[model samples]
Target chain A: MLLLQSALVQSALVQAALGALPAARPTWNLALPGQLLGALGPDLLLAGGAVLLLLVAVARPESDRHQRAVGWASLGLVGLTIVAVVAYASRGALATEGPIAVDTFRWAVDIVVLIGTGCTIALSMESNPLDGILTAESHVLVLFSAAGMLLLAAARDLILVFLGIELMSVAVYILSGLDRRSERSAEAALKYFLLGAFSTGFLLYGIALVYGATGSTNLATIGEHVARYSLMYNPMLVAGVALLLIGFSFKVAAVPFHMWAPDVYEGAPTPITAFMAAAVKVAAFAAFLRIWLDAFPTVAYQWHNAIWLLAVLTMLVGNVVALRQRNLKRMLAYSSIAHAGYLLVTVVVANSLGASAFLFYLVAYTLATMGAFAVVIALGEPGERNQEIADYAGLWTVEPWLAAAMAVFMMALLGFPIAGGMGFFAKWYVIDAAIHAPHPQTVLAVILVLASVISCGYYLGVVLTMFMKPRPANAPAVRPVPTGTFLVIYLSAFTLLLFGVLPNGFVQLAHDSVPISMVGAPARAPVASAASR
Target chain B: MYPLFYSFCFYLFGLIAIASALAFVTRRSPVAAALWLVNVLFCLAALYVMLDAPFIAAVQVLVYAGAIMVVFLFVVMLLNLGLPGELADARGLLAKILAGLAGIVLLAKIMSSRTAVPIESLMLRPDSLATVARIQGAVAPVAQPLFTEYLIAFEVTSILLLVAAVGAVLIGRRRAAAVEGVGAG
Candidate 1:
């Protein structure tokens, strides 16, 4: 009788505990191909292309002809991915489930990355052969890197972000050291790998801390938790945010963490340098904007001062250092650093207009930088000679068309008004956003202008050296321009002019692409928060 | 009486793990360090078992002490390091001091953070050992989460491994080719 009574009490306790437990969470359906494809069409396309390229590379590893063919095929695949993204954008389809997000902001960034990839492939066709990097693996690595960039831009979870970053960075590290014969290339690769791994450690630790504090890795859930719990002063969350900012600052080449940029940029293959300066920056900034705006806007006040200081220092150091650089590649590397500062200013603004401005500036910077690097590659021969600023002396006499294109790129980078270049409008948009920000960011705007004025010193210096200075008698004769390189140069220059003269269409596209739920309307909070609740 | 026994076991395993870890790091010889690390791993496995996670405990021993340590030993032997004293870091005194200072700062930061809260408070669904063992068993609780919510991460990890494998092959082949060409010349 005593044993029977004990069994009854145990049953009653079990029943009560079961009743108090939360309901079972819903499981995602991973078997549905159609829905998954609809959500991840562009990403799947890029990943498939990468795998196909890798298989082809393994099959024909020794054929230079096969490598060139793979390069062209990768370019075609990027073009197709862009078309699919545009189709999705037109349908206004968005996915907010799992670790991926498909929306206008992602599509817009995808387009930029695809265009940059296409241009890089085209530029690499002849340049890689010259630099002893013409292996089939080089083309395959580019495709994989592009896929990683797409994933980086579309990720909504911290784990996915880290994976995407590693995928992209590992491929780029290999590409940087592709010239196995050069010690400088090996040094650049080693430096990049070490520093990149260190920053990744900081990023992963920050993610772990943020997850500990908020009990979620989903951006929307973290945002909701911060809002509901008033965790603005939470020490763990603050430290995580600071660490994340440092990691991103290193990736984007912001000042104080900008030491690796110049060396890596100068030592990498010129075409790869162009890709890193353009597509990699676009993807990193995309991730940076999404995380900060979607996850931590509620506590913006805590991070705003830190970003402001980063911007000011980045601007001062980037432009001031570029003034002293004699190597053209190093100068452009510093220029890219200064551009990151301007982009950070837009991030600080953190409004719909600011988002649009950020997109526009990335487009402008990408076009000008790609065009500029094409000129650099054309000047650099098989032995990596003629990379000095003095190498551009009397380029106008030797190669008039190339000289003209280089002049246009330099003017665009300088933001000269008479040239009506895209850089001018891009800076104008940034300044306007800063002035119209919720907080008084007028001082940032003034600093931006001052930095632009300082930038003119180097930009115009390049132009003058190319056009006005006398040609060196011993200058190596200009090689015949490859068709692929010529195409990249012309396409970049034409688009820059078109956008500069008629910025309205591109501006409209960027404005329409603003992530409404996150930035514009705050009424419809991120879908993850609602669904999780 | 049961709680006292459990606490005693926990402290015993924890102390063993800590001591083994210290020895692992301080050993001058690579082989000795690896052997000490195996001891640390075994102690951790014991701690995991005491926490009613027998699955994790098994993995802790199989993966870390078994497979990983074998690989470590193989690499140590292949390298044929000349002497223990020659293996020490050749940095200046200032660099060593700075590294030590940085490590101390990191330790202090971690200790002061909220992460140092009592382990009992960190459990999402606390239960007695008997209840945990009876309700979910060892493997089911871990398997459910690993196969479901973390499925994507698991697949991505496979891709990462594949990329690393390919990169290793490419780099190794290139070095081999360069070395052979030099010898032939």
Candidate 2:
């Protein structure tokens, strides 16, 4: 009896010990927001939209009948999210404690990304290869990629940046090869995957080096350490910064590292290419600007010239190579690279105006590219790739609306004035910032203007081919208008022109949306506290 | 001596990796390229071990070398690419020129990069066995935070992967059926 009692006591003690040990940390409760209402607002909405899409795909697996409905609903949801993001921005209610800041800066990019995603979804619904892949995956990947882009634009740490880049890239790599029937598509996916993995290696190693030099992956902490200790000359840190630049430049399709751009753009579904050229480019450049501006502003003297030289090479190479391209998508791919050069000029200035210019240019770029892709999707027939310049000859005759939309895209891309649209203002802002920079950034500005001039060659080539070139005697005529694709084309064109003409309102919002709370808070407060002093 | 050891190990692995990477790209035989890529991955694993990221090093070898490379080999063989003419057609002139240019540029960049300083001095409280242990303990919380903060994202990623897997299977199955029909016809 006594032995049994002792055993019971021992068992009780063991139970107590087990209970005291931290419960295997719950996965779903770690960093969830406190207030239930705010907790799942945006995330829940995004999830709900995804679930609805999944349900739609499952309900009608083989039929393409209600595809137009899916496109319309997706666009409406995306538009709603843009409004929600704007509301969040205005209320200043985006709360977070991690390396990602959820603020107005993020909101602006989110709006642009969502719009780009909406256009891609619309195009995908119309005339992709549709190789037994669910439309849900397409729309879901677009949403997820946009979310990742938002996170990337708001990242304040190396870890967050890497995570965001991987998230966006993995989805895109898969999206590029969606139409597995096409050898070109598969080849494009393989090339992008290999190159992306290679660039990731550089980014990861650079992060390790940066962490080693500063003993932190947090951007603000690194900046503070570098400022106080003057370790800009540290070889490891310098190498890390340079490698990081290369990795991000690759993501943005900058020169030299942009080898994958033309092939991938030509090979992928037209909409995905448009999303990549517009939204993904914006997100990458935003993150790139934020990282450098926050962590390496003091070390600008060291790496400034490297970036300048890269900007010059990127502009020259992108524009010159584009002039020789016969493929429309490949030409746009190079044109996007040239735009990256213009954005890099803003980074060269490394100031508030530079930040504003990036945001403004993103709107114009997104609208124009999405509009262009929409037109391409609308005009293209099955098995008849509209990528070749000759394929678009006399488009003005059959599809005058599409030809007009394409003209808008080409003119905006060339940065032509007033009638050409707000793209001119976007270019002017970037140039002005570069010229007025505290540093010697005017050189980048000059190169940027020259590059824009070079861009006119290909842009006009497309316009001339569509308008002036006569049609073949017995070319296949356009069939009845497809409802879904026509919607995408008209909407994209409307947005492009609307923003171009009255860009001031959007430009102001972007300027005010800068994520200054983290880095510039101290500078903003007029009176320094005793602690600060 | 410790710094020299680190430098030597980094260079040794780096050279093996670079050579294997070149082999992977240049080899005409897809099977041979896959093997060389495995070698490159193995070298990278060793370098990770020397850098004190033993867990990551293990994951790299296990996931990349073991799983990914095996899948790559399967796909290459399944495609039945034994035609001599087919193999020869793969290496175009443009590819050769681009590869050469890329290789030279990469080599120049690597050579020009300044030597990185050793990191021991900057380690918070000077890294020790105890510090590593502490970090390992903290990893649970770090992981916890990631899950909580990104629960939707994590779940979505799982779903995405599942969909992709099923999609790939569906595509392969459909293609197989179409081939059967053609053969019967």
Candidate 3:
């Protein structure tokens, strides 16, 4: 095989490239292979997996056989991804001046994305006639998007950030439209693509302006240039920051730019929406945090208040709009937008606590969202989509356990204190970051809390419908449940409870991931200019 | 040696890009718009060559021009959009006003901010038109910081692209099969 040979060749090339570097001297802790793989391994493996899955799909004409192959192979590929992560993790953190920073922070976030993708794949394994479209591509796209998110989490260069954003968006564009059986999926895809391309132009223009202003795309280099040249608060620099904020805000689905969220989320399959909600948000926040952490620290005084305004607006708009949605999926979509706003408070803080809060909240949110979507996929019937809240009018009779699991997920998402729940802790961490931020980020924190209270209305609405409302006598009997759906649901629920109870494990993990002090790089001031003072 | 060849390639592509961009804006028909978009993609690929980002350029061509644009053209043809009427009637007052305002603002900003970027401290400086690799080598010191500190992040970017390709093909293939089944029926 060509596939095996290509893998070997690629690995050899990577090894050669690493060896050829002038500073190829092996650091005591990190083997060059680990260091290189930490950066490129996920991409290579996903690429290989994509090829393998494609080949397997084409090679096997039998649909059943293909589905089986897709399920196990996806599991295998995710397993390999875990191996790569472990390999990179074992090598520990490396301090380099590379365009991407690699350390525990990135590795931790990678695990959450990878796990979420794995769960989505598992939830997708049922025998819908639509599975033909939903098959291996969903897994591959999730992997690709995850890869983009991982790169974004660690990117230290504006160009790399742009590339990562495209990488994530392109895959998502196709996946969102994967269910061609419905017209809405195609509509969602088209809308997302148009908006995504427009935002990309804004981002590219911003990068050009920033490059023109600072003559660099490397965040650290730009920081140095600003410090050395005293160009902080320069008009061009300020304009560049504003444009960058607009572009990223759109990606994260912040207010005003969030028109695409409810439609796209409602249009795409529930599992895919879960991926967008959890993995995409985490990665976007990761990149957003990195940019603000490295480049905007000095000018935080100037940019801080502006971001605070956006944060408040996004939170308020997201939560308030979510209250009226009749569609459960659409409601969650609005809630997610609101959640993005809530997380924005921490990002606005842009400190050690903020970083940790983001990491912790990301994990908690991913678990809760993935768990909720898993239930949706289980309840949903073929050809008949389940967007209506009225559809769940049940005595808790058809599926009592399912209803209970759904209730827990809803409560967690609302950040309600369900006794040792991760949701409560997740919100607390974000609020804590906002409260203690070196700057006066508390006002944003107040908005975050108020928006969360508004969130309780919709989240509780889902619970009331699932439990109290009665199913009609003429309702069709629920279909036999698949093994995969059950597996995903229980796994998500277990983790949600586990993390909630043993909050410190995840808290410590989050604490360890904050990019406070990097190796081989000096602490970059916010907006100190090279020519300043 | 390589830089010379690469520069020629870049210019060739750059010309194509500019031409396509013009076509994209000028074209009245949706089909023409799609086609011009493809051309713009090709030009972008060429620009990538000059920029020394061969991988990205290749993706720009393959994914955008090759795969994505084909989809766009397919949809445009399928929709059977009729020819457009005269622009005089089509242009609403709001549209004309917005267009004028945007153009004026853009022109004003560009004219006001026309100062050239200063690069006196840069060890090697390439003009905007140089090959990407030349730009890379000229900015080798800049490359040092990117690779030395951000190397891990760089490799992860490659994985992201691979995933995008796989995701696209897989998603496309399913609908493709369904479309075929319907056609046969």
| Residue-by-residue lDDT tens digits, candidate 3, A168-247 | 88888987887768788888988898888888878888888888889988887787787788778788988888889889
Winner by TM-score: 1
Candidate 3 off by > 4 Å: A1-39, A127-135, A516-533, B1-176, B183-185
Candidate 1 Cα outliers beyond 4 Å, as residue runs? A1-37, A96-98, A418-420, A519-533, B1-26, B46-51, B58-83, B86-134, B183-185
* Candidate 3 lDDT for residue B46: 73
Candidate 1 per-residue lDDT, tens place, A1-533, comes to: 66445534543432232212124322233235456545777887888777877888888655669878888888888889987877666566555555677567787788888888888998888798887665777777777788888888887888878888888888888778777677777778878887897898889999998898888998888888999999888999998988899999989999999899999998888888998999998999998888888788897778899999999999989999999999998899999999899999989988777887888888888888999999999889775678889999999998989988887788788776636377777888788788878796999999999999999999999889988999999999999888988988877877777667655556656665665245335322111221344
lDDT of 2 by residue, B1-185 (tens): 38998898899999999999999887877888889999999999999778667666888999999999887877677678633345767788998899899989998877766575547776657365436545775355446745875544455466456545644654455466557767999
> lDDT of model 3 at residue A431?
82
Question: How close is chain A of candidate 2 to the true chain A, as a TM-score?
Answer: 0.86
Candidate 2, backbone clash total: 0
lDDT of each: 0.80, 0.72, 0.73
Query: Which 10-residue span in candidate 1 chain A carries the lowest summed lDDT?
Result: A522-531
> Which rank order by TM-score, best down to worst?
1, 3, 2
Q: Clash number for every model?
A: 0, 0, 37
What value of lDDT does candidate 3 attain over all alpha carbons? 0.73
**What's each prediction's TM-score?**
0.84, 0.75, 0.77
Ranking by DockQ: 1, 3, 2
Model 2, residue A429: displacement in angstroms? 1.2
Candidate 3 at A122: error in angstroms? 1.0
lDDT of 2 by residue, A1-533 (tens): 77445544643442232212232321222134554235235544654675576567546644455555665677777777766665555455444334555555666677777778877887787766334333445665676676667667667778767877877787788778776456787788778888888898889898999899999887777888998988899999999988898898889888878999889988887788888898888888888888887788788778887888878888999999999998778888888898888888877877766777777788888888887777776666664265578888898988888888889878877888764576776787777667766775666777888888888899988999999999777666766656766776676666556556655445555555565443233222101111253
Best by DockQ: 1
